[model samples]
Target: MLDASGYTVISGPVGSYLAERLAAAIASRNRWNGCVWLRRPQRNLRSLDAALAEACAKRWRADTHPTDDPRRRLERALLGSPEGAVVVVEVTDLTTAIGRLMTGLRPLASDRGVRLVVVAEGLRLPVVRFAPDALVAPAALGGVDGLAARVGLLASAPVAARRLTRLAERRPAVATDLLDAAAVWPHDVLLGALAGRTRTLERVTAALLDLCTPAQRSALETCATTGYWHPQLDTGVVRAADLRPWLVPLEESWSWVRPIWLAPLRRALARRGPSPVVARPAAAGPGSPDDRRLRPPDDRRSRSTGDQGSRSSEDQGSRWTGRGVVEVRLFGGFEVRVDGVVVDFPGRRGRSVLRFLLTRPDRRCPRDQLLEEFWPDVDGRAARNRLQVAVSGLRSALRSATNDHVIEYASGEYRIAPAVRVRTDVEEFEEALGAARSAGRPDVALSAYHQAIDLYRGDFAADVPYESWTLLPRESLRLRYLDALDAAGRIALRTGRIDDCVVTAHRVLEVDPCREDAHRLLMRCYARQGRPHQARRQYELCRRLLAATLSVEPAPETTALYRSIRPR
Candidate 1:
């Protein structure tokens, strides 16, 4: 139900069967006043603005303001439309571009009489927080009364259909897969697959598990063994959205793994018996933590407080003794390991404290600053207590795998132990970039640049992009990465590596669609390949992105390049 805001957000997996059915229902109801459906296909490279323009073409037939952007154009068109006119937007993914677009449209849509329906995958916090009314449509695939009819099993074997539905964990996607298998195989073969007598079910289950991080898998395994998750477990590290169409929420903090997955998890656990190997962390997107052994620190100098830099007890020749460095990965995801084993923190807050301290150039931070940064919403005394608890928890977690003196407190300041050797991806990334810049030879510089680029798995601490302290640093690292890519592209172009130039240029556009220079780079690459038509298409995409999103034309340089490449 929508409140005074006239904004309704449907939360679920974007392409799921239930979400699509609900969207169709909404469109059917709003057909009287006119419903504009805006959707982008998976393979479509067109921007969201292009989708919107196409959807509202009939409504926007009348002249719009000359200076209006996509938002304003839609607003003008909506304001003049009949009452109850609704715009149903199908969001493919929640990128930065979509976030900005939604924020601007929310208020304008609220003030107007028309209703705005946003069908988005995962939970969009901004949409939920800003909207006066929001609804999360359930994704459960319960009830088997009409299930057999839908899958063509009711007349032939109703009982088997009900049993199959239950075995599929009542998940529409899983049930559909089972039905597809049934169609291809004989009854005995299908039964064998379901019973795990064949490898078919195992293969399918393994594919789904592959998407999860080590932590998520561990959590799921625990849930499979026990009925519920431990209350103190940091489930925030498990992105529910990422587990979608398979894992569903049983309650606010607990998740219900589909029945299809339960037997496989239990069997795998039984096979391992004791000391099961923890899978390394997968290379996930922002806020994703993956496990991999990090390279040791290049420098062996101890971080001592005094000018003389006396080595502390813990640092006394540990590097030579062959104890591995405490590898802290802050880029892409937040992960720490000692001797190649992943360290598990007590909670997300403890991990956050560790990340905050690592970002400090001096490796020390004032106690007051930490409390203010991490626990600002709480009262002073409570916030201070929380900070201490977080720090203590962080220290304990690290101590389990390394020296007890990994963290130290002195004179109202908290810092990493001066004696401990640490290596971080962020440092490695910067060092490689520095090496690239200082290299005298083009080949040397190009190699350094590629090394730096590879180190940047994703944005810094990408898993927690919205945190207050990470905002500036995240943007800073992203710009540096873009610059490195630009440099690499230019060098590759000069060296006659047309393919490398094209690849780097495409990577830049993926991160920031409005990167006009990257578009020009692609234009040049395509023209070099003697593909003027493709070059013109690139220019048109650039112009449309600028006009629709920024309400501006491409720069003069871009136009001139396009003119030269045009089939004149």
Candidate 2:
């Protein structure tokens, strides 16, 4: 196993037998501090509470304190265990509870240094199926890296192991096929086929497809098309399918049945080409505002439960979140709005903490990481206490809009769970910048750039300009804003929008007073506006800025542009 073996998938012809043995083999080794085997209960535990009671059974409980959330209890359990301790969760019972399960597990992989080894019959897991925040590492068991450990596990089931080994000995390719299929399909199916006990790939896939009802087929198509399934999309089909032993809930809302066999099924379903399982939204008509789907999302993210909380409305973009409607505008100034109404957070440091978390790409900042980032000058104990206080103040203020748990704590990290619809101008600005760059057509690109420019009213977190947390994104957005200005200026000039060009170039200089490109664009816009002296004055400003800033003459291009615009 890799050093940080957060997740390992074991699958092959005898994958089920091997999965159990793999756990057993690890159990045999006395090197670990502790181990928890997560098998389906010997007795029935139908509800999640029941299942957790069974899964957790006497493993984690503080002598002085008791916690109810299974996720928290598991974290406490793992924290109490020493390094190299293992938890083997049976996929069969836990597939439907993927989100709750991953919410507990994913944070631990990073914060606790724990390794979760999942033994499944195939590549399908609840994590892959849902496409939630994926774990850091994903390794296949039949693959080369962990081969020795898996080889020893084969002895647990002599008959299946011996038969598979014999088949591999004769064909040799059987071993290769077994690994390949194990990556995507069930190990048993691959083993049966390679052992000449089943049909060809096409028929094997078709047989699997035949087993799926239309609803199941549709669900497979959706996850395949979208790359992950979200349970919030909880249709009758998806919900029913989720309960089955075959469905594995991955990280967040990802889904997979036999991802390896999906390609052939997709091909068979659409022999013509890439036919999306769901119909795409029609393009906006001429004179229409650019659709958020077609552009970077400047608007608030959709709160659609129908699509499983994934923001992307199309084939591959976005995760729809629940109800964080408290929008924080970080552009011109800092303003927290709940449902479009302005509200102030309780204390001074509360805004800083919220700003830091809002700026983080993943939104999960460990308590220690936050201390290092925001309070490097303070003592560790003091900083941690300060953070706790600030968290309380922030949550207190946000409690009216969100619950007291809007700022959530788990596994040594605190993250925002601010209702369902939370939006930040900074996040939207970055998204717009990306959309502008990725837009295919020049017009589309120009439109996106213009939209991005409009969204960026001022520098990022202008109120907290000097904060360490604000500097990186602030500068990044500043550079991107400059680029958008330059691009938009050119587009305006080319399209005969001279006034817009002048405004855009002037705005560029407002941000970076020495930008020769902006100076050149202004010179042209001024010359085109028949303001020759103004054009010449723009060149003089560029020359002086170069001399003052860099102590050197303006570039040859600037001088050449100045000469071109001389009053004549």
Candidate 3:
């Protein structure tokens, strides 16, 4: 067995926070006998060392070779022990440092004796000298999204982490001293007090005022006053060519002042009144998606065609609005309606592939997962080709109903995007049932469970009941429905709605007649109403179901429940 390979290179945006986090992970690895961190002797490097100590819980001694030549000293450091060791080197300037170090480190890096890791900023690492196999690159942190993530990485508190994300999402690309303050404490820095005039705050305020024209400053003040900035809504700003430079667009209609300076700008503006937005000489930056875009896929779903009932029918008006409101009914049967028109999945493979994606529509499903599930016997190349053809077929099948939003491929994976409001009955049912479980009030749970049962028109993939692949999913849906019905009945009984309890219990029996719990529930409901005959009848039905379906008599609990309820 192989012990190790050439050193790995983890490349990302340059920050002590990221490097420290990586060091912590490397230190935790069991195989490494030793670890060393190399960097230039400077104030920022010292800060990194301090962060490393807190992050990985081990202080690394600064062992910069004081030898006559730095090259020899750096070479000796690179060539750690012949055995196993992990080496992390920080680079401020990638071009000059990387090639020179790699030239000196060629033997050690290639020997595989020690694992070499290079940590540097994205800007510094223009071109890497290390082998392509060794690079582990994560995307550069961008704007509020990136900042929010950075806050979470450094903060331990859950509430603080959430606040950090909220702040970053809401104020994209709007850098401020207060925003930078989040990384300072890492744990709810927003909750901290601002006492005397801070230099960083003043500097940030000055920078914003300098960046914007007099009119733009006034427009910002008006925005701060209103608590929202609509560039189009402001007539003067709309006509100005410098609006882009004055404020970067965060969403369709909304824009925020560059580099934030919100608190400072607000205070500055209150001194006078609203100002016009004048043209700035500098070019505008690219627009970013609104914070609303960060909403979950399920949340992104349009509520226009809100809730659909189980076995409930509605005449959804037939209109092929390119909006692609795809309604998938999987329980009881399979039906995919585009807008309001029924679309046929003319092939088994297409239907199966679609079903898997529908179950987990929020993310992309890789080709391998789909191939292994459906085409287990086929080789990789053939399976991939088949998948491509199948995807095309699906698009054609759903062209009228779903149009462009049906099945999309990207990076060798496929997904059903939420661009088309997708409402699958099974998902809706499970969602309702989940809501019931979390619901505090019995009535809430009762309503949820009832709706879940109603939405389940038939078994999941009931159209392909005998198909081998369909068995597990079909059985799963059936069992969950029975469980939901059982909970609904129990809630009904607890709420003194005995008639509703009896009805729910009967629904459970229709799904799984041999379920003794449903039988006992029905008997209890009848007995509570003083219908001894009905209770006795429920006991006989349970006995017959047990004998016929499972060849077993009632359990001790069932017999005792019958005795308690029947003519007693």
Best by TM-score: 1
**By TM-score, is 2 or 3 better?**
2
Residue range 53-94, candidate 1, lDDT tens digits: 445656546456647665566656666656556777655443
lDDT per prediction?
0.60, 0.56, 0.55
Off by over 4 Å in 2: 1-323
Error of 2 at 387 (Å): 1.3
TM-score of 2: 0.44
**Model 3 stretches astray by more than 4 angstroms:** 1-322, 361-363, 378-385, 402-405, 566-568
Clashes of each: 6, 37, 7
Error of 1 at 316 (Å): 21
* Cα error of candidate 1 at position 563, Å: 0.7
Q: Choose the strongest candidate by lDDT.
A: 1
| Structural similarity to truth (TM-score) of each candidate | 0.50, 0.44, 0.42
Deviation (Å) of 353 in candidate 2? 0.9
* Candidate 3 lDDT tens digits, 410-448: 887789875767778777788888988999988667767
Worst 10 residues of 1 by lDDT: 299-308
- Which portions of model 1 miss their true places by more than 4 Å? 1-321
**How does model 3 score by TM-score?**
0.42
